[model samples]
Target: MNKKWRWTIGISSVVIVLVVLTIIKIGTTQGAKPDWYSAWASAASSLIALIALVAAAVAANATIQTNKTQTRQLAKLEETQQSDRASKFAVWRALHPTRDSQIYRTFFHNAGPLPMYDVIIHYFVNGHEYTSKEETLPPTSTPELVKKSDNNLEWFIKKLAIEEYGLYQPKTKEEVAAIADLKKRAEAENVRIELVRAINEGKNRYVKDIRIETGVSFSDGENTWYRAPNGRLERTS
Candidate 1:
C-alpha cells in the first residue's frame, strides 16, 4: 500500500477512537446535557468527511503516477527493439591475398537481423571523398556474402598522388628527367614508399600518408540511421 494510504488509515483510526470516547461520555452523563457535547459530535462528523476526501485524492494521485511510470517503461522497450537489428550493419576493411597485402578493400556487410534499404557509403582518404549507393543490402552470416567496392585503398592512394601531388606518367625525356630529380629529392627527404610508387611502380610499397575513413547511412523501411567511422550510430529520420 502507498505511504499516503498508510497515513490516511492511521488518521481515520485516531478520529474514530475520539468520536467513540465522546459518545461514551454523552451516554454516561446524568442530568443536563452539556452544550459542548453536540458541538463535539458535529465536529467529529465533519472531520470524518474531510478525511474521506483526502484519502480519495491520495488514491487518485497514486494511480496517475503508476500509469506514468508504466508508459515510460513501455516507450523505452519499443525503442530498444527497433534499433537492435539496424545497429548490426557495418563497414569492414581487409587486405586481399593476405593481411600484409598492399591491396586493401572496403566492404559493406549486414550482420543485422533485417535487410537495409537505400544503403549509402562515404569514403574519405587523406581528405579526398568518394560516395557509393545501393538500393538494398541484405543481412549475411558469412564472409562470402559481403559486398566489395571497386574503389580500393590502392586506387585511392594512386588518385591522391596524381591529383594532389601532381605525379603523372612521363612521356618525354624532359619529363622523365624531372621524375628522376623528384625521386632524388624524395629519397633525401625520406619520403614514404607508397607515395614514391604512386609516381613510379616499386616493390613492397604499401598505403602510407593516406588516412581512410568511412560512414554509412541506411534504412530499415520504418526508420533511417547513420553510422560514423568511429562506429557511433544515430537516427537521422
Candidate 2:
C-alpha cells in the first residue's frame, strides 16, 4: 500500500497496543508492580513502532529501485533489436544495355534486423566520384539506378582515344583512321569502377566500400558491373 496509509495503520496499531499496555500497567502498579515497569514498557513499544516504520520505508524504496532497473534493461533490449534489424547493404551494379549509355544501379536489401535509412550509394567510375541522384533505398527494397548523365560520354570517348592512341586530335585526312582506332581500343579496355555507401541505423551510422571488377577478361561484357546474386540486365521497356 501507499506510505501514507502504511504510516496511518502502523501508528494506529502502536497507539492501540500502547493504550492496552498502559491499562495493564496501571492495574499492576496498584497491586505492587514497580513504577519503572510502566516506563520500560512504553519505551519498548515506541522502539518497536519506530523500527516498523523504518522497515516499511526501506521496502518501498527497494521496490521503486527494482522497477527503474527493469525499465532501463527493457529499453536497452529494444535499442539492440532495432540496430540488428537495420543492418543492410547497398550494392552497385552496371546495367547492361538498359539504355544507350552504360548505367550503374544501386540495389539494397536488408541483411540485418532493423530498417535502413539514408542509404546513399557513392561510386567512382574511371577515378571520378559520383553520388547517387535518387532517394535512398529502404529495408528489403531495391531501388532503380541513380541516373547520371553529368559526365559527358563524348568527353570520355575522347579521353579513351587519347589514352590509347596517344593523340588528342587528328587531321582531317586521318580522321576516319583515328575514329576506327579509338573504337577498336575502347572495346578492348576495361572500365575501372568502384562503389561505396553510407547508411544510418538509429543512433549509429556505417560506411562500406566494395571493389568492382569485370566478370571476365577484357571482352564484350568486361565494361559492365554487377552485384552478386541478381545483378543482371533488367529490360524496363
Candidate 3:
C-alpha cells in the first residue's frame, strides 16, 4: 500500500517477466541453450535476493519511524494533562458593602482536580502593596472571600487622610457640629478644608480612579505557581 511496497512489487514483476522471456527463448532455440544462459540466470537470482533484502529493510525502518512518532505524541499528551492539573487555581475580585461602598474584596478559587495549599494573594492599590493571609483551597470548592479587616481600600484611604491632614470621621453630635463649624469658617475665609480639598483634587480619588493590581501564589503539594493580575499563570517551583 505504501511507496516502498509498491516499488518492491514492481521490481518483482519485472524479474518474473525477464525469467519468462529467457525460458521462451530457450524453448525456441534450434540446438542447446546459449552459453550466457547459466550466467544470466545466476545473476538474475542474486538481483532478486538483493531486492528482497532492501525491501525488508525499508519496511522495518518505516515501522520504527511510526513507533517513534506515536511515542512522542503520547508524551506530549501527558505533559498537557499535568499542566492542566497544576494550573487550576485563580484569584477573584468583588465589591464589598462597607465604609459607604468605598472598598472591595479579593477571593480565591481552586478549579483544578487537586487541592492547593499555602495560598497567598498580593494586592497593589495605586502603587501601595498589601498581602493576604495564607490559606488552603480545595478542588472545585467555593470561592473563599478574604476577610482581613485592615485590607480594604477604605481603610487605606482613611489612614492616609489622617496621616497627611489630621482628618478623622466625627463619631458624636458635638464632634460633627465642630467639623461643620470648621467647614463654615474655612468657607468664610475663602480657604479649603485640607482633607476635602485633597479628595476633590483627586489626590485621594474614588474607586473608579483607583488602580488595583492583584496576583496569587499557591502550591499543588509538589510545585508552586503564581497567577498575575493579567491572568498569566506560571510555575514558581
Best by TM-score: 1
- Write the residue-wise lDDT of candidate 3 on 117-174 in tens digits: 8877777776777777567767766777666623554566555545545554334344
Show the lowest summed lDDT stretch of 10 residues, model 3. Answer: 168-177
Q: Which segments of model 2 are wrong by more than 4 Å?
A: 1-32, 88-109, 112-118, 122-237
lDDT for position 110 in model 1: 78
Cα lDDT of candidate 3 equals 0.67
Best by lDDT: 1
How well does model 1 score by local distance difference test?
0.69
Global fold similarity of model 3 (TM-score): 0.55
How many angstroms is residue 221 displaced in model 2 relative to the true structure, after the best TM-score fit?
Answer: 37
Task: Encode model 1's per-residue lDDT on 31-72: one tens digit a residue.
Answer: 766776677767767877776776777777879889999999
**Candidate 2 — which pairs collide?**
84-113, 84-114, 85-113, 85-114, 86-114
TM-score of each candidate structure, all chains considered together: 0.65, 0.36, 0.55
Residue runs of model 3 more than 4 Å from their true location after superposition? 1-36, 94-103, 122-135, 148-208
- Candidate 2 per-residue lDDT, tens place, 56-154, comes to 876788699789999999998975554333323435455545547654343345454343333334444345444443333334544433333223332
**Is candidate 1 or 3 superior in lDDT?**
1
